[model samples]
Target: MSDAYVALEGGSVVAARCRAPGTSHGELVFTTAYTGYEESLTDPSYEEQVLTFSYPLIGNYGVRSERFESGRVHPRAVVARELTDDVAEWLTEEGVPAVDRLDTRDLVGEIREGGAMKCGVSAGPDASPEDAKAALAECPGMSDYTDIGAQVSVSAQKTYPGDGDADTEVALVDCGAKESIVKSLVERGATVHVLPYDVSPGEVSDLAPDVLFISNGPGDPANFEAAESLVSEFVGEVPLAGICLGQQIIARALGGSTAKMDFGHRGVNQPVRDLRSEKVVMTTQNHGYTVADPGDLEVTQVNVNDDTPEGLESDDLRVLTRQYHPEANPGPNDTLGFFDDVLDMVDCRTPVAAD
Candidate 1:
């Protein structure tokens, strides 16, 4: 026998001699992103959650440093249908360890039937699967993920490379924003100021930025009333743009509402159709909630797959929001023109005094 795969839960040895890690206690959730494993693992949104990959074979292409969204992997633990013994060459170069393989199908089934619970993975002769499952059953579900934004946010304000000697300044509200978004803004020649997620409108007004940007984040957008109020206060004062959580926050600020999705979109293959241009763009996304009352704002783009609202723009308020990521980190580059569009918006709204 293979030492009778042992399972452990809540630090107790429930299974013994398992092929997988002994036990890892956390709220288990599955992702169907297909690829971009490195990005998914490093996403601050998955904090405290054990991730299970629905795609059976993983780590075949291996991990690369260039693909990492952050400095390190942040998942509580990783579960996969089968962990590859041989990772790609880039992963070896980056020194990322091959994921300890597990029966992902069993893990996903258990999470679905049992309704998402805390669990652990361990490696030892004494580890028991039964004990692991029992301990996980006692753990909680994903209820307080809204707090994740505050936890992962940057501690202090910072700036990144922007279009050198730019005419307009853009204030980027960092709700655990990806570095690539900063890079995109910088490349556009727009001076960028990265602030904490809770930055107030008064602070932004004091900066006198030409544009405001809200970055993507994790968790329920409804919990961020302060951010919504701040954006509302800044409406029409400056050209504003947002992605993912930023989009939802802007919608709420504009008298709209947001709701959680049955299974939140989290991948690179999502298709969004631009209403004005009637162009289809394959984009990346990682959000749990979307605007509920898009009519309150001017809807700009819609998802063809499910008819979900994808983008919104309010000409009266000089603000725009997109539910998908245009940064294209670990995804397609079809929608990168959105960055230029933002620059144009800022140009159109430029204060005559600054110009």
Candidate 2:
């Protein structure tokens, strides 16, 4: 077998061979999760960046076809410390390519020292590691990530099956959204209409939904000018809820601010505490940006590790959001009730059976 070239900055190999060609680059970040590699790759929040796995071994358990959050692989690049030849049987079933391996410790050290930089991974002997590293180093950072939601958002409208005869209708804005979030709304007896990320509030208002939902996605929320306005207009006029990128957008609408994290939280076991209930919940998280300073929005939940804002609410507008995934698939179930809370906020009363 021929050797693959990997790009490194400050001695860390941030990109490896076989990543998608002609892809834009950004700072490479690392995630410590031992599992959920599939979910991580498809997450929109990693839109402009490459990802490095801190776990020593990857592709051991392999990829699952049934576990995809989005329609395609969305990461700019994926780097691992070691690659296993004996990929799991599930990977063969799924038909996803095995990730190229590189020196992860070196990559981690580079990101830690340099703070983060754009990088790429590709295959072939002609792929020069030095050239790729230099190209990536010169590329811009997270500022470009602002436009990521528009790039990855659904191009057309869509819908999902819900419980029979549901009274509540929900209009969900897809910002590179995951299917599970739609499933949660459906299970709660809601008729869901999925729209593109750039849809305006007036467009969604035409749907006459009882509640508006902003799904988690990739990129910086500040760049979504229309979305910010739409969300802001809908606040108080109708019930609203959001997660991940959606969360940040809602905060922005409510006069809050978001900032890029030092390293970002990407795992299935991140712990968050509910300031309202004073309960700690382990959650699935995948995002490079977070609410920098929640100016007017009331902070409801906070990360236990770094005290970063995890959840926020504007009671006056009936708007609520979370920086982490409450619909975690391969992660914890502690925050699942948060979805129920969303339904309740929208005043979707449960029907009482005849006595």
Candidate 3:
């Protein structure tokens, strides 16, 4: 164990006393999520990013391999006010850098006001302002990391047997899919064919799936050109749906545009309103970018706090998307029925059988 410290883009050490002897750098972002540290650490969307946990104490429940969202940890580093024995041990074993024993309140406030910034963390006792400055210089900007999504995406196609009763087959294009997303489909009796981020529309069409599912992932949606092309090719050809990064891609495919938020939403308590019913549902979410304008797509749900687009739909195209996680592994399942909508949409397109 060694002393650790965290530095921001300005070369200022925000916190210190890190015990792990590892160094990391990335965009410094905070998540107000109070639980599910394991799931958050493994979420692919956190790739190339340093995560700050706003919760006072972390790792109270210990680690479990089954709780991981991805096969490996995705965050570059983690900052917290206090780290429990179980958590610190798990992070160390995983080779994930972490820092604690300092005032996270000040650090979080700095991020809240200044927004997420590029940052560096080191577990060496000799960490200083110069070390911080040098690390900052080496840190790449978020937009500059265009290959992040592909880096986290599956290398080849994989298939999961759907547990749902329907004969529906779904072609899932994995940008950086979460394990829960796959489970969500398979448990619902839908066979999911997971493909690479750059898989062509022709390849997916050849699968003869009843629906096209775009998965939530890392990086900017604009950087995923092949996925956008696939979406463009299948807009009217198949029933389409996505979540988080998937939502942004669908927006881009429909001529809409996404923008990086000043401070992105990441937590389980975000309230979103279903425009049709004007009803609010607390949801789980994690993303730095959002669909600012849905273009020709109809807006279905909105964030109650910021009025950002939370969900989109198009009856004519049979396309649907949500910015929050419906699978809700670490949060509420209020929108779990959202999957039912996908099934219903497929059912509508299914030709009735004659007796």
Which ranges of candidate 1 are over 4 A from the true structure?
Answer: 1-27, 85-126, 134-143, 350-355
Candidate 2 lDDT, 141-232, residue by residue in tens: 66765567677778888877679776787888888788888888899888889999889666786777778888888766787777788887
TM-score of 3: 0.95
Which sequence of candidate numbers ranks them by TM-score, best first?
3, 2, 1
Alpha-carbon RMSD of each model: 4.6, 4.7, 2.9
Give the backbone clash total of model 2: 10
Q: Taking the tens digit of each residue's C-alpha lDDT, what string does model 1 give over 14-132?
A: 22222333345555567777788878777766666666678887677866678777665555556665656433233333333223344666655665565455565444455445645
- Local distance difference test, each candidate: 0.70, 0.72, 0.85
Q: What is the lDDT of residue 30 in candidate 1?
A: 77
Off by over 4 Å in 3: 350-355
- Enumerate clash totals for all models, in the order shown: 34, 10, 5
> Candidate 1: TM-score?
0.82
Give one digit per residue, the lDDT tens place, for model 3 in 1-355: 3367677875477657664557778888888889999999999999989889889898988899999999898888888989988888878888988888877788888888888899888776676656656666789978888777678888888998877466888888898889998888888899989999999766786787788889998877888888888888777767899999999998998889999987699888999999999999999999999998898799999999999999999999889899999999897989999888887788656332222
Q: Supply candidate 2's per-residue lDDT for 263.
A: 73
- Pairs of residues at least 3 apart in sequence or in different chains that clash in candidate 3: 4-18, 163-186, 163-189, 164-188, 164-189
TM-score of each: 0.82, 0.87, 0.95
lDDT of 2: 0.72
Best candidate, lDDT-wise?
3
Candidate that would win on TM-score: 3
